[model samples]
Target: MIQALVIDDQEINCILVKGLLENFFPDRIRPYATSNLAEALELITTLQPELLFLDISMPEMDGFELLQHVRKQQKAEVIFVTAHDAFALDAFDHQAIGYITKPIVSEKFVRTVSRAIELIHQKTNTGLVETLKKAIITSGNNQDKRITLTSQKGLTFVDPAHILYCESSGNYTTFFLVNREQIVVSKQIGSFVSKLESHSIIRVHDRYLVNLQHVTSYIRGNGGLLVLINGKEVPVSVRRKNDLLHFFDE
Candidate 1:
């Protein structure tokens, strides 16, 4: 069975999360719910659950505080559930397995939990450092200046300037770089789009994130295709064609 813990000051939220876990995993999951951070910390140390569902807003000890404490004690999978969208970026910065918004939909909740489970299994089998590096590299923006990538070998810090573009393959994202190296990370194109918005990278298609710096020319074909420095052609979405042209013009 997969042991889980729910930490929320509000009883309703705790119950809601517990119910979802029970429904999703049935007999394979056991959950411990608590309102107090102190009690939660104790349970976390002793129980060492495979997953933790946490709330960002709480009296005395906030979600970030609890996360820091957990990091100090042990490395357990964490998914933060919060009402405030403002905390989403911060939650990602802390390497949270997932950041779920309030009034969680059953589908999204189950998906997030499943993702956490997969990540936990991967970390347990491979190692934590490798997983963390891959997450940082895939989630970083070119303007971020730095990123991290992980593998069975070890973690590698990457300079975003070296990245050429990112492509999505099924459930994975592959990063193409200037030096002819590629880094495959476990993330969707949409997630990378949001994180790399401030950088030179733009979503040219549903499956491609192109770096404006590497774009040499755009061929106006049936829809459109962007030609990169390495002679690779990437499709441009019809909806974003005009916007891409305007961005280049500016």
Candidate 2:
């Protein structure tokens, strides 16, 4: 069963959302709702829900702020709820998967939730495939030999130690190597995190993931910059600076 959460300052809004979920998706979803911001955050941590219905305007903090906190913990698909249309663009700016305005229409709500459920199913299936692939590849002592990557050309087995960094451009990720070689793959940078992160590859910014093994030096600033072995510099986000430092501290 998929876990779902609803967050709103107004008790009625929470109740209404929960009711809608119960009515439309009684068997598929295990629904929870909260009007308190503190309780909502706690629930998000504990439940690690796959879907979140969040009210954009709230007393303590808006949905966007809460969503940022959620992202740090889990990859919950968000559906922003608001009374005004102005917040719609802002919701998309935050990369919310769906947005709905009040008073909620049953048909629209069903449509949006249907899409979210489909996406969740797709991710679950993909995860299963990846798990099987990893099991087959890591069956022997050759586990650390190479990581498989798919590009426009074909599948490439790469040595993780040779990777300098990975850069993201929209949906594409370009892998840069220590030998000045580059491989472009048609997938989000986040998709490769699990596969490459074990090899000292860490995301330094939204657009850049760096291999600490190849980092020559770090230049400090607000966020900072990393000089790689191949004389290439990668900018680190301020939010991720402490993480990079802590990695070295350990």
Candidate 3:
């Protein structure tokens, strides 16, 4: 079963969305609706739902503000349901799993929810199993592992300690290890980043991603740059330098 929460100020919108999800997903969907952000936060802290459908415009605390709070505590995938199209880009910038515009279309809503459920399974089941397997292979012992990666070739088990950095290459991503080897993955860096974002990986540039554990120094070049433990330098766009620096400071 997939646990879900719906946060909207309007009762009708909440009921409509809940009914739609129930019709499609049946007993698999656990829907909780609330008009208050504080109550939603409380539910999140306790229930730790796998999915959250949020409305951006609200009375006291809006969806964006609620999202910030949710990201701090839980790994729930967020799907923003908003009336305005202008906030779509901003929602994605915050790493929202999906964005749905209202008045909600039944087909689109179902499709978005399905995607969210798939992502939940991928992250919790497949991703975690790979993480554990990596620990056993690397340590030659049975212990919990922290990170894992999959590619076109095969699963490349890794210790977070051995990772120097990661870089995005269009639709593909490359991971540089401390042992002077690289892991090329078919998935986009954004996908990898989403999985590892809660860990040490940080986005230094639009195309360049780095694991903070392997970041040796920050250099101010023509544009800013991140010097990794492997002695490789990755250019950071001027626009993202401040955000990177702020992330490090935290």
User: Which predicted model would earn the best TM-score?
Assistant: 2
User: Who wins the lDDT comparison?
Assistant: 2
In order, how many clashes per candidate? 2, 0, 0
Runs of candidate 1 with Cα error greater than 4 angstroms are 127-250
**Order the candidates by TM-score, highest first — what do you get?**
2, 3, 1
lDDT tens per residue, model 3, 26-90:
96678887777678779899888889999999988888888888888877889999899999989
Candidate 2 residue runs with Cα over 4 Å from true position:
139-250
Better of 2 and 3 by lDDT: 2
Every model's TM-score = 0.52, 0.56, 0.54
| Candidate 3 regions with alpha-carbon error over 4 angstroms | 131-250
> Model 1, 1-250: lDDT tens per residue?
7789999999899999998888888865798898887889899999988888999999978999988988897777889998988998899898898989998988898888887776765566456655655665688845235665553335456666677899998878888999998888776778777667677888988899998888899999765999999999999989989989899889
What would the per-residue lDDT of candidate 2 be over residues 1-250, giving only the tens digit for each residue?
Answer: 7899999999999999999999999987889999999999999989999999999888799899999999999999999988978888889998888999999999999999988987787677557647756886778657546876666465666889999999999988999987787999768999988888889998999999999998989999999999987788899999999999999889
- Global fold similarity of model 2 (TM-score): 0.56
lDDT of 3 at 50: 87
- How well does candidate 1 score on lDDT at residue 13? 94
**Clash-forming residue pairs, model 2:** none
Cα RMSD for candidate 1?
10.4
